[model samples]
Target: YSHHLKQGGAYKCSASNIRWEVTRETHIEYKTTLWEDHLTHQQRNSWIIAGLLWEITANSEDITAIHLPHFIDYQALNDLDPPLIQIANFKDGSVSLEPASKVHPTRVVFENPKFSLLGVIICLLPCIRPIPVKGLVMVYHSQEAADVTLHVYIIPDDPAMQEAIKLKEKGSRHIMKPPVVRSMYFGHDYLLKSPCKQVEIKPKQGVEFCYVRSGQTINFYEVYSKNVNENITLWLHAMNSETCLWEAEVRPGDLSSHGDQTEADSQYDLINREHRRNLIKHINVMQPICSNLLDYNIITDEEKEAILSHPTASEKKR
Candidate 1:
């Protein structure tokens, strides 16, 4: 899997220039007669698009169209056998495959009176050569007595898989500073090596870097620290190649304790939740607030999309 999913978006707004963002939802077992004959092959391609869903919301009902970005590359799409692509718009618990009016290397343009959850579903042959994918490396750590343990995961950059890793790491500190994306093959041999002296990595001699989404047989590397309080770096690269694909530095000292939050912070969060409705009802202006939220890094782009989804000022405030 050596493919990457890049997406961009547009919504109906009066501002000549505005910020936009894209987020993904889980994949659904979509059924349609469009590709009835190739059902099995399509199923094999489902994991590639499981988190490919893109959600877009706008304020204007009379807006002309929405351009949704999908996972499949236009170049790779050209290589697709017949290159069949359809927009799966999900709403009210039912999903319909809508033919996009326009398709480009980067975007699939479409128009809808109202649309909710949407993702691109591409039909391709199962026997085709492997495509590159955007893969993620997650590093988790725990220290007990004089020993430190590190668990590293290299898996698909899917929403569902990442969420499962979150649950899997509960009470364990995620020691990675930031996420590092790498291009990988589904079953190819990728290497994870560390230069730390005397560190013991399990199954090291003839291990293959194997991974299934998250729920299945998850293949990870468990490393025992050579010395207590020692920092380490894990290197990921293709086997037989020295080129570094991705690297993560685990520094235990940089992270705060689990209970580091002060009482004032907790009280502020409580008040914010209690008066959320009051603020939503009373706010007369929303555009500035939305922009401020973006500027202050207080809300994610997904949250901004949700806030703008509401048509009215009070509704958007909510």
Candidate 2:
């Protein structure tokens, strides 16, 4: 789940800083071979110094064919479990081991002509299931008394399985939102913010409003307007859409014949005015709530205090 490099004075890039320049102090050679029995006759015969260098240098675009004929032990190689050898020009270099399933031919390459200790192991194919393997790199110095250093690196195959292991450490199903009916009324606009996770609204007879949550639903009947003669219930459904105002309907009550044309026009104007006020209020209330809830906490302290100070039905009754 986590990765860390081992720390020690041995692994340190510089110990006392005598400025150990690898190029000036050391003459180096590197080579790798599979166990003699594992290599075919063709592989043994065709394996010229040029061919070995070509394979090692192919992945490194900066390395050219001019640098060749590096010394390698031909007769000493034998068939072993980890089947390869590598030769390098520096005392310090990196080694990479890629699984056979994830790589073709299972090879290593130096990417740069000015070779430091960096090696890249190309994994040609994705690893499947899991496999175990070992790798080793030996760093030799020119001075006989200088200690030979070895750096080892390994990569396990199952990344997907590693992710599954990480998931086990953290418990499942934490609640993101708490249950509540968050509503605010501003001017003629009524804004409702809920942590119900889902919401549904339906228009019934009369100018009644229904608010539903997880375990209960509250209905508001004639809550806003008292004049029921020309009642027009505007139901806004928020279930199918994000903006409730976009999905709204108006149900009109029957008009009396005795009503004057001027009176009817006035009533219609009043309704229109109420609707427009409601729209503005909706924007104001939802703007703050949505901005604070969905975006960063943008609601100001002054606005929050104003909401808290405002009297409710229970306060009025008291």
In angstroms, how far off is 191's CA in candidate 2? 70
| TM-score, candidate number 1 | 0.60
TM-score of 2: 0.12
Question: On residues 1-318, what C-alpha lDDT tens digit does candidate 1 reach at each position?
Answer: 111112333322221111222232211111112222222454545524423454444432433455554434334545544335667666665666677676665556666425466665654345366655557788776534146777777776554566677787776666645664555666677777889886777657423543343246667788787565667777887878888888877765734453453355578898876665454445556567865765665544444555455566655557
Q: Point out where model 1 deviates above 4 Å.
A: 1-42, 45-47, 50-118, 126-129, 143-146, 205-214, 254-256, 261-285, 292-297, 300-318
Each candidate's root-mean-square deviation in Å? 9.1, 33.5
Q: Report clash pairs, candidate 1.
A: 1-132, 1-133, 1-185, 1-186, 2-131, 2-132, 2-133, 3-132, 3-133
lDDT leader: 1
